[model samples]
Target: MLSTPISLPTVFVGAAIIFLFALALYPSSLLRWFQRKRYQYEVTFSLYMLTPTEKFIFNSILFLFLAMVSIAVALYLPRHVRIIAHRAYYYVSGDLVKNGTTSAVLGTTAEILTPTTVAEAIGSA
Candidate 1:
């Protein structure tokens, strides 16, 4: 008996389908983790009351620092295959596009346009 070898495209699509399935099923847990990591400092700060000026200054500094750190990490982090795999899983399986949650959360025309820019560039030009 002989079995046919799976073509690369089929394998890739299959992997994407499986990843999406996982994301759909377990997105809450993934989201919880992402929220914890992303807003941990904000959660900590919520315990204190802040005057308007203090709030503005604190948030401005915190966000600036976060932006810088995020950029630095994006540039310096090791490009690991597993990270790519997980992100691929999230993008394919996550309800980001189908449910339109990402756009709703981003709440800006520019944010909405950004994904289209990437997709169009990658798909057609």
Candidate 2:
């Protein structure tokens, strides 16, 4: 059977047989898959269904985990970077207040920015 040449029709028939057998074994699953949902909701398990004590414990553990992660991040990351990020996040000045742009400018800005002292432009490279 394994060595036999398999065609589409033979494979399909075998699948149909298996599916029909499965339909008998698990009618609800088959129905859910084949049937259009009358109302848009599914019967499923959820943690929200947990008891009051379980929910409290779960939330406590979750918050504790989140706090630990927050503290770790705060501790692991340097202070200056955090300050810069915070400032960047809050800064609403909007793009340097002037769109300083130049078309077809290749390192001309670098030349302008570099100060020429004693007839020798400070080595850019």
Candidate 3:
């Protein structure tokens, strides 16, 4: 049996649901995982052992770096991923052969059988 193709939005929504479920059910485990994973490398220079002013500056820099990375992935990566996935689906499904068009455009379904013969319709106000 042929499987139905999942849309990009469906994939994202399903992922978000799983993420939320994990957060709700396993909050302590997630925290433990973070604590276990962190500080794996030997601290040549320790952030935790810094003076108050130095700690604040180090935290500020770290926060900025995290924010930049998050924003870059959130803003740009989805659209890029979707375009690539759609192209891959096109090749895999042979949608061009079956549908005789690429992905559906967001508009009316009425077919344009012929080009309209245009008369000069602009009137001086």
Instruction: Please report, in order, the local distance difference test score of every candidate based on alpha carbons.
Output: 0.66, 0.55, 0.62
- Which residue pairs collide in model 1, if any? 20-93
Model 2 has how many clashing residue pairs? 0
lDDT of 3 by residue, 3-72 (tens): 9988999999999999989887777876877766555421544755778798778778988999999999
Model 1 over residues 1-125: C-alpha lDDT tens digits? 54988899998999999999988777887688987875766567872466768878988898899999999888767555545655676577753333333434444334335566546645763
Which number leads on lDDT?
Answer: 1
User: For every candidate structure, what is the RMSD over all alpha carbons to the true structure, in angstroms?
Assistant: 26.4, 16.6, 20.0
Which 10 consecutive positions of candidate 2 have the poorest summed lDDT? 97-106
Clashing pairs in 2: none
Best by TM-score: 3
Runs with alpha carbons beyond 4 Å of true place in candidate 3: 1-45, 97-125
TM-scores, all candidates, are 0.28, 0.27, 0.40
lDDT of model 3, residue 53: 94
Ranking by TM-score: 3, 1, 2
Clashing pairs in 3: none
| Candidate 2: regions farther than 4 A off | 1-45, 79-125
